[model samples]
Target: MAEKFDVIVVGAGMAGNAAAYTLAKAGVNVLQIERGEYAGSKNVQGGILYAQAVEALIPEFRESAPLERHIIEQRIWVLNDKSYIGTHFRSDNFNEERPNRYTLVRAQFDKWLNGEVKKAGATVITETTVLELLKDETGKVNGVRCDRENGEVRADCVILCDGVNALVGSRSGVRKEINSKEVALAVKEMHFLPRDVINERFNIQESEGVVIEILGTVTEGMLGTGFIYTNGESLSVGIGVIVSDLMKNRINPSTLLEKMKSHPSVAPLLKGSEVKEYSAHLLPEGGYDSVPELSGNGWMVCGDSAHLLNAIHREGSNMALTSGRLAAETYLELRDKGQPINAENLKKYNQKLENSFVLKDLKKYRRMPHIMLENKQFVTMYPDLLAGAAETLLRVDGVDKKTKEKKITKDFRSARGIFGLVGDAFKLVRAWR
Candidate 1:
């Protein structure tokens, strides 16, 4: 006889661990399976972790989770070849009793989360590949078939917490395979620096960190961005581009990263650092328009599998955790009401997402991805224009302020034309709305 579980959560990623921990703590017999050797083994790159979503699941996460440093500064930069126009927000308020964000190494963080899941009584099986979803004669998913011998396991329902690829979901016909245009390929490297050097270079205390989000030519005019995050003793730097653009241009992601690291505005930051780790992963950048069906009979999808990533805000893990928690809560409510895990009952999960900020934020920026992808000027022409204008205005070379202002206007108009500039602005406004 096959072992039965109240819920079987596939992929022990952020979403999987969150859902499995939530369900197990609620007295549900949950089986969590991971294809990697351990949770987070496939994801070693450093990234930001939003406190609100994490605290919602594990209220005392900060006490034990493998957090690197609390973010006290955030910088957004638009780069030209040799110069960058940037804005930074830094506040001592971020060093308060509970910080809003932190830099974390995903491998250690996920391992910590897996420990929490086990503590919550979820049975976790590592190195297990779930081949496909098992459906009954009525076309309702009821279990999963794994790669191992007699690897069929029954469950009241299954949760697809798979990453951006959503292999199982796609194979089971739950969601369509992601298009290259709707995803981004991000390559990251962790450069090791002494703790004191990191602190001195970033002008931060031991517990504080800085994050830099770069735009413009760094992506080679692609619709993507580059980033640098400060960890305890390392800097996480990376560049990403839309997969479609990469394929269309035959641009190698590694070459682009190398160029980004060599840029004048970025090179000094890592002058003497040693590269300790390198990894790459796909990110869902489709915004709201590309999200597929989230729930069906006896199954639901969360995180990247559901295309819940909000690329505009660089918010993925938080959205994943929120969606996972909401899915678990929805299932628990249904079970309490004596309802079966069907398409009708799982609609509550989608409803919960709609009521939360997850869907609301995604809806707000629904047009951003398309606009950014279509308008190459934001990453190409505008950066040069802004840099030139700033230099012309600042370098007091005996030129009158009025003439310099006129020269800036003429240069912009000459490059983009008036109609192009107006159209780009209009599109940007529409997308931000």
Candidate 2:
């Protein structure tokens, strides 16, 4: 006889864990499988977690989860060769009873989340890969086939929370294969430093953290961005570029990361830190147009597998958790209604996402990916111009303020003609809308 379960969840990442925990807690028999040796084993380093999303799944996570720091300040930098222009938002409000955001080492946090799933009574099997989706006579997904002998496991439904690669779904013709242009390849490094040194450099007290996002020249005109995130005793730094841009520019991501770290403004923060880990991953940056079919008969897709990332806001985990919760909720509701997990009933998953901030946010910035791709000036020309303007305005070379302003204006016109400037502005406005 074949093994059977109420549901089979593939890949025990944020979305998978969230869905499995929710289902098991509701007394639904769920089998959660992972390819890694253990949960989070695949994650080599760090990221920021928007607290609200995970809190909805596990309210008391802040108390026990391996959170690195609570973000108290966020800085956005536009950098040239030697200098940067930027703004920051910091507030004591972030230190309230329940902080809004946090820095987390992905390995630790994911293991913790998976532990919760196990405690909730879900059967979790690590070091197991689901080779393909199993279909019934009517051609609906109802189980998965694993690598082991007699590995077929039947379930009423299957939930795919695989990462951006999403191999099983794509192989089964359930979701489209990710396009190189729609995704980004990011290289990240973990620089380990002492707690005191990290605190001294970022000017924060214990438990408080800072995040820095950089753009312009770092990618050498490629459409990409770099970032530095502070952890408890280390810093997470990395750079990401569109795969197509990398191919067109013929640039290596590692070299770009080295350049970003050596920038005068960035180097000092990691003067003597040791390199702890390095890993690369793909991100879904294609915005709304790249999202594939999310649901079908006896199956649902969530998280990066569904292209649910919001690149504009740099949010992924929040969307992952939200989608997973919604998928589980949809399954429970439809089952209660005595409805089969058919194409028609599973669309409640889509309806729930559309009604929530997930789809709404992605739809609002649907134009940004194209805007970034088309406008090279935003990445290269503007940063140098902003730096030069700042230098002129701040350094008194005995030039009058009016003359300096006129020179800056002339430079802008010379670099990007008046029409070009207007067009860029219009595109920005439209994209932002």
Candidate 3:
């Protein structure tokens, strides 16, 4: 006979912690297993935390969670080698009593979240890898087999939150192996700076932060984006590229990140910062089409494992947290109704997601990924054209405003024919809509 629990959650990232905490808080016997020394040891993120998602799980999280800074400003930059055309949104509204978003260090935040899971009465085992899913002859998963000796544990249901490269799900034939074309490889560095220096450079006060989202030639025509996030005392800077594009273009992600750091527009912000940490992770960018089977007999997949990322908005954590909570809620619903944790009953989990913003937003921009990947001009030609037009209009080089406007129009026509421009606009609108 093996030890038994009501539910077993694999991995301790956003999804896993959320699932385990939700289940345990509901008084369900949940066991969360992590392969790392502790929760968040293997997790990496761009360091943005969506407040509403976590608030739904733990309303008072702001009082205890290890938060870095609340974002008060956002900048989106279309970059060239020398210049950028960008938009900035800053408001006093973000400084309200309850901020909408914050920057956090994943390792600290995950550890804090896992602590909540434990305090809620869930069993957690760290540094132990679940080797495979345990299934009965009926082809229904019921538990997991871990690397430790005699490490078999039974559970009525299993929630896979193992991440983009989850092995247990793929190995157990629960989901298809990830496709390179549908994933992205992101490399990031943690640059430490004094808190006051950070605030001064970004023109903010303590507890206020800034986020810069970058697009354009920094990726060298690859399908991806770069970002810089301000923390309380550090900056998170990174670049991500489609794995297939990296393979096809033979681009090195680390080298690409280095080039982005050296960009004239980006370099000044990072001046005098000391590099303290570097990490890389894969993210699912497949949108609605790439989502795998959500649930089956005795098992459910959530978060990155289910391909629940919304790349267009750079939102992963919120989806992960929300999906995890929904999965747990689904199990609780079935249990209360005296329904079996079989494929038929678990279908409700998928329905729940479909009704949430997690799936709705992804479906809305489902075609954007394919369109962006197919059109290189979005990351290359268009960025350059925008930068050039900005320069043309602002240089004050003795040319009349009307003449400068005409030159800008001519430049666009010369770079991309009128038909090409119209076609690109159509594709963008079609995908975005």
What's the CA RMSD for each of the models? 0.9, 1.1, 0.9
Clashing pairs in 3: none
Q: Candidate 3 — which residues are off by over 4 angstroms?
A: none
Q: How far is candidate 1 from the true structure (C-alpha RMSD, Å)?
A: 0.9
Candidate 2 — which pairs collide? none
For model 1, residues 1-433, the per-residue Cα lDDT tens digits are 2799999999888899899999999999999999999999986444999999999998988899999999999999999889999999999999989899999999999999999999999999999999899999999999999989999999989999988999999999887888999999999999999999999989998789999999998788888889999999999999889999999989989898899899988898999999988899999999899888889999999998889988877899999999999999999999999998999999999999999988899999999998898889899999999999999999989999999999999999999999999998999999998
Off by over 4 Å in 1: none
The TM-score between candidate 3 and the true structure equals 0.99
Candidate 3 or 2, higher lDDT: 3
> Which rank order by lDDT, best down to worst?
3, 1, 2
lDDT string, candidate 3, 1-433, tens digits: 2789999999999999999999999999989999999999999999799999999999999999999999999999999989999999999999999999999999999999999999999999999999889999998899999999899999999999999997899999988899998999999999999999999999999799999999999999999999999998899999999999999999899999999999998999999999999999999998999999899999999999999999988999999999999999999999999999999999999999999999999999989988998999999999999999999988988889999999999999999999999999999999999
The better-scoring model by lDDT among 1 and 3 is: 3
